[model samples]
Target chain A: MYEFEFVKPTTVADAVAALGEEEAQALGGGQTLIPTLKQRLAMPATLVSLTGIAEMKGVKAEGGTVTIGGGTTHGTVAKEAASAYPALAALASNIGDPAVRNRGTIGGSLANNDPSACYPAAALASGATIVTSSREIAADDYFQGMFTTALEDGEIVTAVRFPVPEKAAYIKFEQPASRFALVGVFVAKYADGVRVAVTGASEEGVFRWSEAEAALSANFSAAALEGLSVPADGMIGDLHGSKEYRAHLVGVLTKRAVAAA
Target chain B: MTKISMKVNGKEVSGEVEGRTLLVSFLRDTLGMTGTHVGCDTSQCGACVVHVDGAAVKSCTMLAMEAEGAEVATIEGQANADGTLSVVQQAFQDHHGLQCGFCTPGMVMSATALLKDNPKPSEAEIRHYLEGNICRCTGYHNIVKAILAASGQLEGAIAAE
Candidate 1:
């Protein structure tokens, strides 16, 4: 890691001001950022630590929606959000490991937008709303691509609001090494319809499986997805698995998620 | 350099660290508390696991300044009063949970954290909770037994011969 000035701000306003400094970056749990810094992939003159901001740390559920502060750690979400949103909480509990869950924050996970991350699938499938320092962004518009979001420079995600689904479940085919999803699927059934999202399998990043959503909405069951399949094209292919394999897993995991839901 | 103060192993310690200084470096180099090893500098290995504010985290992945005013605990603190091995540590010894012993500290720390949350984790739960702490030698059978024993779930298992 290169030499940099670290500032911990107690408030989102102060954090934004600190981040507005020339070449300054917002530091979340550092689960991903610290590694990136160690690899010299990013160099910033200043790092604005966001963990100290108490206002951005908590989990609140009311009126069929669960709201979680951005700085709230995955460990907290796994425990706090379990009753309100079991599937999301289960997703939080399984991310990385116990230690990683202790430090990694939902805000950091959403902002960094790792293609293989679990939160993206949850947010997209649930159609959660992302509240930022400046404004609120719908999850549909929040995630732009892998490692990319609609966040502007100095913008910070303060909270995410998830509509509690009638029934939901996430199924992940984890890559042995990183524990990231080789192919993961989240199935959420709401009052109006069902939403299906796939992560860790796409080159374009977390995406809604609309066909599966439509099929499942019409009849929410694993049997409804028997004939549907995700195309191998645009899927991630690496030493872990082939693009075709990932596409196949996406279909399989989606069915599993539906069955589990 | 940032001047930070925190309680580690029940001791209030203060140090000057650079913004880039990892918490493990502060514990291992600044305080000379080397029990918290850094088997893999990357967060994957779990060798640098420690408790900051009473939760297990990868010290190597966290900056020293991030632990400001937080109560930190490491393997050095895992021992009981009067220097006896803690239950988890004693269980590891009785079960022969370690081989190379490189991953013992982390294993003990993670197991302690697990047992704190779950008093009697099933075999599958113990194995699942230990996903981050890798032991290349033990194949995790004894480690699982040690954790189960620590939770007092291993019926008729003796703590010492």
Candidate 2:
């Protein structure tokens, strides 16, 4: 890794100020940043460590909503959130073994917006809000594209607020290498309507599968998605599976998710 | 560079490191605590797993500064000061839970944390709990057995002495 100035800020204001410096990156869990640094994929001039900022940790569940701190690890979420959000807890429990879950933060995952990530679909399906230092972004508008987000530079995601859904489930076809979703679907039904978010299949990144949503809305069953066709256009194609296969998996997994929910 | 102070293996240690210095690097290099190994630079490998505030975490993927003021426990701290192994470690030895041992430290740390949280975990529960800590050796069959045995032994020992 290239040599860079390190600043451990004690507060969010200090961290944000440090991040405003030239080419500074906010260090969360470093589950992704450290690897990127080692591979020379990212070479920032400074790193503003957020560890000292106590505000960016823990989970809170209250009247029909679950607010998780950005620094909350997957393991904590998995183990502690079963009663409030069973499907999300299950999803967190299944994330890259114990070690990854312990170190990888939810905010980092959502901020990085890895196309194959598991949390984005959950965030979207649950109608979560991306609470950043600057502004709150709705889940539908937070993820822009593959490895892209609505976050502006110097802005840090503080927390994710998920509205407790009446029913929700996440189904993932994991890639053996990265253990990330080859094709993952998160299905949720609220008083508003049913929402289906597909991740790991789109080259353009996570997008709502309106067709699957429409079908499931009519009848929340596995058979509802039997004949659905997710277009292959702009879907990610990789060694794990082809775009068409991923598209097929999305439909199938969405059905499974809905049924499971 | 940043100066970080943390307790590792019950010892308070401090270090000066670059912004990108990983917690694994600080443990392995600055402190010369080489028991924590970095198998994969990425977070995929659990070889760098260690306990941070009683939870097993991948040290390799975490910034060294993140550990400031946090309690850390590595494999070196698993055994008694008298050189006797912990029940979990003894169970691994008795059950042949390892082959290459590259993933042992991480596996042990993860199991320790799991058993701490759930004293009497079933085989299926053990497997599910350890899903994050990967071990290519022993096909994880023996590892599961060892955790079960250790769980029983630890409980017995705690009850007896």
Candidate 3:
């Protein structure tokens, strides 16, 4: 790990000021950032810790929406959001195991936007809004690609607002080692229409499947997607699975998610 | 360098450490509390589990300075005041839960937290809660037995001990 200055701020204003330093990075949960630092993949002049801000850590559910603070750990979300949004809570409960859930945060997960991450799927499928210190961006405009987002330099995410869906479910084929999604699908049914998001298989990162969304929006059943064929081109292929295999799993899991919902 | 102060096993301690120093190193090297083992450099292994602010967390993935002013409890603190084994520890012994004993501390810490949250968890719950802690020795059968026994859900074997 590289030598750097560590700064912990008790408020958002102080955190913003600390992050303004040259070559400084915002630290949340440190589940990913800490390991990145140890491997010398990231070398910043200062480490701005966001765990000290009391206001940015909790969950509130009311008025047809569930609002969660950016710094709230996965454990808190798993416990608190169970009654209101069981599918989202189950996704949080199953991420990385008990230890990793205690430290990893939703804001950090969405910001890092790993190709295999589960939160991005949930957010996009549910039409959750990503709230930053400056503006609120819809999930459609938030994710750009793998390990990337639309976040500007030094911008801090304060919270996320999720519109409560009539029904939603997330199902993933976990890569046993890291518990990350091999090809996860989240199906959300709203009053207006149904939204389907797929993660871990796309080279372009988490993306919405308009065909499945249209099919499920009309019928809302597994049989509605009987003959749809998802193209295998541009899908991620590695030691875990082949592109065609993942493409097949994508169709299978989407049906499973819709059936479960 | 960063100066951090925190409570470890009911004692207030302070240390000056580099920003890059992990909490596991601070506990093992700086404070000489070597009971928390580090099995993997990555965060996959749960060998370095510890309690921070009354919640179990992986110490290897957090910086030492992030634990400032927090309460931390390690494997060294799991014993009774008279030096006898804790119920979770005794159950492990009574059930022969360990063969290599490398993942015992992490398993115990995770079990303690799980029972605190859900005291009378079912068998499936115990297995789900231990998803992070890996035990290559006993194939996890005895470990699950020990955890169920520790929770007082088992009847014959652990009750006799």
Judging by lDDT against the true structure, name the best candidate: 1
Interface RMSD of each: 0.5, 1.9, 0.8
lDDT of 2 by residue, A27-140 (tens): 777777777888888888988877667898888999989899888889889977889999999998888877778777898899899988999999988889999887899998
Better of 1 and 2 by DockQ: 1
Q: Candidate 1 chain B: minimum summed lDDT over ten consecutive residues — where? A: B152-161
Task: Pick the DockQ winner.
Answer: 1
Among all windows of ten consecutive residues in candidate 2 chain B, which has the lowest summed lDDT?
A: B152-161
lDDT of prediction 1: 0.94
- Interface Cα RMSD of candidate 2: 1.9
Candidate 1 pairs with clashing backbones: none
Error of 3 at A177 (Å): 0.5
The C-alpha local distance difference test score for the whole of candidate 2 amounts to 0.86
Fnat of every candidate, listed in order? 0.85, 0.94, 0.94
From the highest lDDT down, the ranking of the candidates is: 1, 3, 2
Residue B67 of model 1 has an lDDT of 94
Overall local distance difference test of candidate 3? 0.92
User: How does each model score on TM-score?
Assistant: 0.98, 0.93, 0.98
